[model samples]
Each structure stands twice: as C-alpha cells, then as structure tokens.
Target: MVFRRGSSQSWPGLGGGSGYTASLGMLRAAVLLVSLPWGAQGAACANVSMALGHRGPLPGGRYLSIGDGSVVEFEFPEKSEGIIVISSQYPGQSNGSGANPMLRVTSLDTEVLTIKNVSAITWGNRGGFVVSIHSGLPGQAPLHIQLMDPHETPPVLIEERRDFCIKVLPAEEAPATRGADQVHFSENPILYLLLPLIFVNKCSFGCKVELEVLKGLLQRPQPMLLGLLGQFLVMPFYAFLMAKVFMLPKVLALGLIITCSSPGGGGSYLFSLLLGGDVTLAISMTFISTVAATCLLPLSSAVYSHLLSIHETLHVPISKILGSLLFVAIPIAAGVLIKSKLPKLSQLLLQVIKPFSFVLLLGGLFLAYRMGVFILADVRLPIVLVGLTVPLVGLLVGYCLAICLKLPVAQRRTVSIEVGVQNSLLALAMLQLSLRRLQADYASQAPFIVALSGTSEMLALVIGHFIYSSLCPVP
Candidate 1:
C-alpha cells in the first residue's frame, strides 16, 4: 500500500470498498509483530547534530552571543533541505539505510533574531545544509530545531527536539572616546547664543523668590515628601506600566523610565510663579528632588530595568546630576544673597525677571521644536500618545495625593507642577552616555517628547489660569 502527498485517498489495502474487516485484521497482526522490536531499538537511533560556524555543537545548554545586525550560520552535516538523515544499525548487521527525517527551524522571538536562507551544501561524502541567522535587537531568543518522520502523513516527531538560545548583544560603539564628543546641537546659532541668557533668567527668577516663603517650606516638609514620592516612586512605576501596556520597544521603554525617574525640572518654579502657585515650594521641591535623585534615580532605574528583563549596564550621570545641582543652587544662592544685602539691585532683577523668564521659555520651545523635528521624524503614535498623557497623569496623581494629605491649594499646585515636569536633559545625557550611537538616538525620543509635552501643557495651563484670573476678580 502506498500513500502520496496531496492525494485524497487512503492506503490501497486500507480502503473501505470491500474486505475492509479482513485487511484490518491483517494490519493489526502486522503492527503487533513490528511494535515490540521497533520500541526496543528506537533509543539506539543516531540523532542529528547541529553546530554554529566553528563554535562546535553550540556548547550544550549555552547561548550563542552575537552582536545586533550580525549574521551567524548554523551548519548541519546532512544535505536535507527540510530533512535530517538518521542511521540506525542492528546488532550483527551492516549500516542501516539512511532515513530522511524532516527538519524544522523556528525562532521564539522574531524581533530578537530570525532564521532564513536555508540552503544545502557539500561536506565531503556526507552532504550538509546551512541556516543563516540574523540578529536584530539586543535580547535573547530560542531557536528550535526539530526532526520528524518525513514518510508520515502529518510528519510525526522522530525524537526529542534541539533548542539553542541566541543572545543578541547591543552594538558597541567603535570609537568610545569620540562618542562623548558627538554632542548634538540645534542648527540655529541663535539657540547657542541664548544659552547664557537662560541661566541669567534663572538667576533673575531666583531673586524674585521670597526667602521667607522658602524658610516656611523648610519648617513644614510634608509637600517636599509628597513631591519626592511622586517624582521617584509613582512616576517610575507609571512609566513602566505604560511601557508594558503599550508594548514599547526595549530601548524606548528604558528611555521613558529614565525620563520619569529624573528630578523635577527647573521649569516647575516658573510655572508656579505664572499660575499663582507657591514658587518657594516649587523651587525647594526642584532642588530637593535633584539632590535626592543622586541615590533614588539609580535605584528606580535598576528596579524597573530588572522588571523589564533588561540586563544592560545603565550609565547614570552622577556628574551631570551634580552639575545641575550646582547650576541651580549657585545661581539661586547668589540671587538670595543679592536680595538680602542689596535690595536696590534685587528690585531691578525682580522687575525684569518675568520678561526674562518669558523670553527664555520661548527660546527653549523654539530649540526643542527644532530638535524634535529631527529626533521624532519617525516617532510612533504610542510614544506620542504616552508623551501627551504622562504629564497630565503625573499632575493629577500629585494633586490628588496633596489633597488627600490636606495641603493648601497653592502647595497642591506647586506639587502638581513639580511632579508633572521632569529633567529630560538629564535623562538624555544618561542615554547618550550609556548606549551606542543608534541606540542612544532611538532611546532619546522618549525624553524629547516628554519634555516638549510637559512644557507645552504647563504653558497652556498657565495661560488658562491667567485668562480665568483676569475674568474673575478675587474678592
């Protein structure tokens, strides 16, 4: 009896035309005779072996490490396209005839690596086949190889399958020293010219901050505690949750987490001043959070990276954090000194501080927009959606927490602004310092989007508040 592929007919002897009962009896006797000997010798069948190029048999329970975008070949000493050759010799008998076993290769995760371009090749008298594997992102994926009985109707499994893991490592930057020098800047020279002016504006804003209000905050530290909790704890977890929910790519997710883990931005106090919130509380929270971030940022990133199954060494910019601290603290301290000692000079700074802040804000937005045009050219919708929503969500979370803690309305607004805004530049610095060029560029989108989103949203809120205040006079 013979069975052919794509034929709708059963084996000739097993057909149901006539004499089916007699044929069935004969088949049962034949199976009974063949089953006993087949089961006993099945264990002795020679299993096919596979090896990565020159690596020798994939090291039994070890993964092959390949850099992203690199190609690796798997070699098998059997000339079967989708088949494996197996030989079983009986006792006191010559070598058995080669059995053509079907071979199947599959990647557990195509995003990490892929198997393709399977072709046969000559390996002396015994022919062979090679499989080309292409690595994608930095992650681990299992490659499954199976041998099956090609003669079977549905191709039954011949024996246990072979599993090999491929670990794709991140592409390493060739010129490590030059990587630090590859700093990106806006094309417009005006942006560069405005940098010092922005710092001057920050100093001016510092002069306007009431020393008494800042002193009052130090005495009552509840708002500071709430801001820290929201900034470090709630924000990092929220970023992680959003990443998981939206299924962001690993690098992008890491970027988002790092951005969320950053300290409250310098812009928070500016927003507070614009919206009639507690500027002292905002400034104090920003400074305190920046200081606390030295420890808490690394902790938060480590915990969440582990959750995301990312094992790369994340570079946290401790120096950058300290520099930001100094940049903020020194200016504010100098301004406070001027305010206490030279009241006339302090009044001059206070008069121009608002205009300076407005000008700085416009300059920042212009620069950010220019940078975003380049960074977010290929940005995904999920990232944009997340970017738009994260600031709003953080604001709501902080406000609700403040309300629950029975804080004053001004302090609540301050906490909300502090929590919503993040130091995206710090996050960008970390990513650029840690990852390779391609990866750094790709990951940086999260920070850029978040920064732009937070700034734009806060500005809109400030304008709305201004309009409302103008319309409804305070009694």
Candidate 2:
C-alpha cells in the first residue's frame, strides 16, 4: 500500500505535519534561500512546473527526477544553499486527493542520515553536498515554494504534495553520497527527555560551594596548576593517544577526548571525603575546571576534531558552552558570595545543595543511562578498553604527579581522584548542546562509555579505601 497524506506508512513521527493549500511554484533558483534555525518556519513557492529527471530535467542531472518510484540522483547546483528543487507537474495537473509521494534522502557517507532541511547556509563557493532520494510516483511535483511564517518542511515539499506529476529518476545504492542537513532524531528518541534532566542537574550545582573554600585556593596555586595539568594535559592527551593506539573510529575517538577533557566531576569533593583525600582541593579543582572549561572545551574540541578528521568546518557549539559555564559559575559564585555577605543563608544553601545534588545526580544518571543504552550498544570493544583504562590511568598519573611535586599526601589523593573522576555530567551536557542532537548521540558513545566505567571504577576505589582505613587506622 502506497503512503497517502494521512497514510499508514508511519515514520517515527517528528511533530509538525500541517500544510497550506498552496499555489504552484518554481523549483531551484525561484525559491528563496533564507537561513533559519531548526523548527523555525518559512514560506514555500508552488509555481514552477519542473520536469525533474535523472539527466533530462535541468541540463545535466542537476534536478532530482522522481521517476516512477525508483532511486533518483541529483547534483546539488553551485551557489545554492544546500537546497535541491524538484517538481513533477504544474498545479492544474495535480491529483487533488492529496496523496503525496514519500522519499528518503541518504547522504554519501556511511551513516544513514534522515536528512531534514529547513533552509541552507552558503559560502561564496562551498560544494560538498551529494545525496540521493528514493521517491515514489514519478513526474513533476508542482509545489509552489513560498516563504511562510509556518511552512511545510522544505526537503519533502516537491515529493509529498499530491498535485505534481514528478519526473524523478531513481538511482541504485551508491557507496558515498554527499553530506548536508541535520540528521534524523531516530536513534535516541529519548534525548528530548535527557536534555531537561541535564539543565536541572546543572542548576543544583549552585549549592556546591563556600567563600572560605574558594579563598583557600590562592594559597596553593602550585597544586592547582598540577590539577590543571592532570586535567587539560594528561587526561585529554592520554585519551587521544589511547584512541590512536586502539585504532578507534573517528567519532568514538572524539567521544573519549570529550570525556577526558571535561572538568572534575561535581561529585569530586564527595569522592575525596570518602577516600580520605583533601576535600577543599577537590572543590577548588571543580570550580576552576568548570569555569575555565568555557575556553578549554571548545579549544580542545577544535584540536581533537581536526586531528581525527571528524568534520571539515568548525561547527563548535559556542553559545551552548557559554550557557554551561554560566550555569556552573553562577551557582558556585552566588553560594560563595552569599556566604561572605550572609553566612546563615550561605550555610543553609550548601546544606541543601550537598544532599539533593547526590539524589538528583543519581536520578539524572539513571535517565541518561536509559537514553544512552542504544549508543553503548553500537560501541565496539576497543572503545570500552579506552574508557575503562583512561580514568584509572588518570588516577595513577595524577597521584604520581602530585607525589613528584611533593604535595602533602592528602592533596595528592585529592588530585588523583579529581583527575580520575571526570565531570561526566558536564561532558554529557556538552555533547547534547554543542552538536546537533543526532550528532551528539553518535559522538557521545565514548564519553558515555567512560562515564559508565568511571562509575564502577570509582566505586571499587572507594570500597578499597574503606577496607584500607579499617585495617591500617590512619592516624
């Protein structure tokens, strides 16, 4: 049974499905190329009667031909903003019953991306988009592409509307198609739920501080620098090297780098207390790392993405990182500022921040784990090895670095745990915000693996510390 406008071919539906009773518009150059964010609406033009064929349509296979339910390949025209206009017939020749054709746009790359385009962004000359559409019911689709505050999705307009008799030529499976547009939100549908959980987790972080704790940091800039070394230098460098040594895939390697580059965990101070380490140093490391990550996150990402060849252009999520920094810094800063200005209020807030943070941390972890189960399923074994070993190595190298510098034993333990227990929550949040939702889910494979590993390994270390304390009775 072929799909109709309100058909039973049920795709894993993504929200907006309303359309207008539109006029016929031209394909290609006639439609306006405006830039807009995802979910932002625009108009469509339904004017042109484009005869989209494999080769016959627009001189040299430039327009997509919907040739009678087969695979059609089209070359994206130069000077176009990632938009490929196709038409079946004129408006008067449309099947007014409104049973629109269905099409799937797959990129030339290995991954199967469900390409959904709102509009495109163009440079003076940047041509790298190659894709194919599997469209049914061939001829010209007389869709009038117009600018609407509320427009039907751009990608499927020519094919979906029933009015045009499309002339699309279907292509067989090509190995490497072109790349453009945001990927489908197919894999991790639960990512929508995970995002808000991330926000709440960050909000609770405000309570994790005191003015006295922050002021103590200036006294030992040396130790703080060591912590930074353990964080920025040892952890990220180690993750990248490990990925190379293990021969991990590009995306997976990026994930590992992200996790290792992340700041000390919000839970670092608690972990230090359990391990008989310096809690104040742990708190200070968390503060500095979180605040400083505004720069480090993007910088480190640029370095690793280039080395790994993840993308050609720099699409780092600048605003998202800034938002994250604000969330982390403001809460801690407010708590510290309030402590000096109003000690009683400060004390009460910390008291609340400490306990609820743990509870929220647990709940958030559970939700994140549910969302990430699919990602972990796709991960191969070498990445698992990287995640498991990297944090443990951080613990070893951090302790060793501190010992070499002759920091007190307590500070050494604190540095070790701080370095070892990555702020995976921050990493996860960054993964979601910095990249497109689909990109985030794919890239998060290594970080989530590291996170799960961190959870288990940290538990083991804490248990060992308790046993050691019972036996040796540290005086």
Candidate 3:
C-alpha cells in the first residue's frame, strides 16, 4: 500500500495554507558542491524537500495516482552546473511506514536517482544523497525534481504540505579515490600445513623402516643391494610419480624430496612394538638408515629440486643429521648395554622414560600445528593434490619393492608401512632451522585447512597398528 499526508483528491493547493508553507526555498548564486563517495561522475546535488519540513494533517492513509506524478520545475537563470537531488517525505511520518519514492529527472533523460541512508528511521531521520552533474545547461527547466513512489498515488507531493526546489553548483575538481581496499589470495592457508606434513611424518617413518631391513641385508652384499634399491630407487621413483600424477607445486614437491631424503625416525622400536613388527630389526635398520640418510637425502633433494623447478641447493645438513643420530643413538645404545649388564635397573629406567617420547611427540605436533598452517597456505594446489596422493602410492611401491627383494610377507608388511609412513617431524625441524638461517618470509596463513596433516598421520599410524595386530594376532 502507498501512503502520504496533507492531500485530498480535488482539494487543489487550497489544503496547503500559505505561499511560504508551499514555497520551496530558491537557489542563490552562492552554491557549494560537495563530493560524495557514492558518485563517480562529476555531479554535486542534494534533495531540497527530502527531509521532514513539518508535520501534515493525515497520519496513515492510502491512495492511487490519478496521473503521472507532478513535476515542479526550477529555472536556473545561469548555466547551472551541478548534480540534482530529488527526495520525498511525509510529515508525521513515523514508525518508518512511508515508501521512499523513486525519483528521476525527465529533463536529464536519466533513470530514477537513488537516495542513500534512507532505510528505516535511524537517529530519527531518513536522508538520501547523490553526487554532482557537470555542465547543467543555462536556463534549465526545473532546478529540482521528485518522482512519487510508483506504489503510491502519484502527483509527487501531497497538496497540503509545502514542496521545495533547490539549486546546486559543481565542484572545482574530482579526487583520485576509487577502489582502495585490501589484497587477498586463494591458497594462502594451504601452504601453512605442507612443510610439517612432508618433513615430519613421511621422512621419519620411511627412514626407520628402510634402515631396519638394510642392517640385516647389509651383512651381505645381496641384502645391501636390496636396501639401496628400497631407499633410493623405489622411494624416489614413487615420490616422483606421485608428484606428477597429483600435479603438486614445486615447493610441495621439494618438501616430498626432503621427506624422502631424511633418515630413520628415532621411535622405530616403539612404533614396531605398537604395530607388532620386529623391534630389533626396526632398530638395527633405523641405525643403518640414519647413517646413510645424510648422504642420500641431499642427493634426493637435489634431484627432486631440479625436477620440480625449485632453485634451492638441496644441501642436507650432514653435521646436523649426525648430531641427531648421536643424541638419539648414544642413549639407546647405552640403555641396551645397561640392560644387558643390569636387567632390573634397565627395565625400570625403560618404563620410566617410555612416556617421554610420546610427550615429546605431542609437544612437537602442537608446535607444528601452530606453525604448519602458515606454510600450507603458500603451497600450490598441484603440490597439495600430489602430496595427498603420495601416501597411497608409497604403500603400493613399498609392497612392490619388498616383493622384488624376495622379502617374507610379514617383513614386506613392515617395510611397506615404513616406506609409506615417514618421520616428517625431523624434516620439519631441519626445515625450520634452514628457514631461520635463510631469513625468508616463509609462512602461509591462519586457520590452516590441513594443519592437522600430522594428526592425520598419527591417526593413520593407529589404524595401521590395529590392522597389523588384527592380521597377525599374537600366539
């Protein structure tokens, strides 16, 4: 329904009391043009009778237009150069029950002018504004125009309340202010999760398993060849193929290379026990693989970098790798030695420290989660898709490699898990150290989408452990 105040169908202008009551203020030569953010065109205009001038007689009533809305024209004696403002209001218009009229200039041949801040009565007012129009012709017909709400009775103004006409002029110049906002990207969050995922889990797990098999195999040349094939050939090839298939980014591919290069995980013995694999074999292989990884990881990184178009030197820190080995290996070797000499004390110590590894891993994962998402966002989609596909491929490649080497079924399963799962934590630590040294802006975004890649791997490990236990139930 349409509503307005101070009008009867045949009452003419008699309902409106005086000329001052009906008079719209005239525009003087002293014109001020204000530029609004909404207008791009060079026009300065405002609604003259847009605001409530005074209250009207009728409060709430509806009517339909008898004809096209009345057009009150203003004569600009000079060439008036400015935008035109058009407005409509009903006196005693409260509870915001009146429709905002669609206003336009018939003279300018333009569509209806839009009014801003004319929504519900806020601060007890509804006002609308628009920018200026340049070069308004001299002796123009109407200085102001009002289009009645098409939904209401037309004739523009209610015959009772006073109507208005305004004259506006142009500003000297327009300013260079347009579209100054913020910059955004699509994949920023994904990059944050990549490094930790690639370096921590995959690198660590694979290194441990490969080394375990290598230790026993390396006692003779035949098995040593098998170990070499598993580490360098099968693993690298699988990674490369997965990257290609998944279309990973160069950075993500580089991350995968780093994972493939890192040596054995420190927790192979515990992981083996949990997964029902051979603990002794896992430890021995872990030792052998850790030693070999310092060299192999660098080589693999270099090759993968070249293939992925990454420009880094792909230099694995042998000294750091050795340092890690010493830190981890010395304590374990000492513990084993002490166990042989004093069984009860050694057993007690083992029990006491058994929880330490898990505690450390938990802390590591937490830190990684906080930092990893930032890196993952920078990771490209190609790299992410490729990285996701790698685990499944690694599993298949591991089984094939084991079969080719004539390994027993149980050993093959162990090797396959080892190959598929890696100690990405180690690689991530090294990457962090490297990033620190390089002083690059190496971060992704917040609220990372896949920052829990580490956690996912942990869940996968649990799944693997349960599956293995079910497959090979204890006698």
- The prediction achieving the highest lDDT against the true structure is 1
Sort by TM-score, best first.
1, 2, 3
Off by over 4 Å in 1: 1-109, 116-134, 138-183, 186-192
Model 2 scores a TM of 0.53
Across residues 1-475, which tens digit of lDDT does each residue of candidate 1 receive? 1112111111111112224433453344334334323321121121122211223222333222221112333222111112222221111111123333434556665556555433222221222233344556656756665544545788786443334455555554454443332335424466568767767767776787787787888888999999999999999989999998888987899999999999768788888888878877887898899999999998998998898777778888989889888878888888888888888988898888777777677768767767656567789999899989889998998899899999999999989888999999889888888876667878899999999998888878877887998999789
**lDDT comparison, 1 vs 2, better candidate:** 1
Candidate 1: give the clashing pairs. Answer: 82-103, 84-101
Model 3 agreement with the true structure over 129-222: per-residue lDDT tens digits: 2223332212122222333443445545533212333222222322233122211222225334543442333222322344445556556443
Clashes of each: 2, 53, 50
Could you tell which candidate, 1 or 3, scores higher by lDDT?
Answer: 1
Better of 1 and 2 by TM-score: 1
Q: Write the per-residue lDDT of candidate 2 for residues 429-459, one digit (tens) a residue.
A: 6666655444466678777777777766776
Model 3 segments more than 4 A misplaced: 1-227, 349-363, 377-382, 429-455, 463-473
**Each prediction's TM-score versus the true structure:** 0.73, 0.53, 0.47
Error of 1 at 465 (Å): 1.4
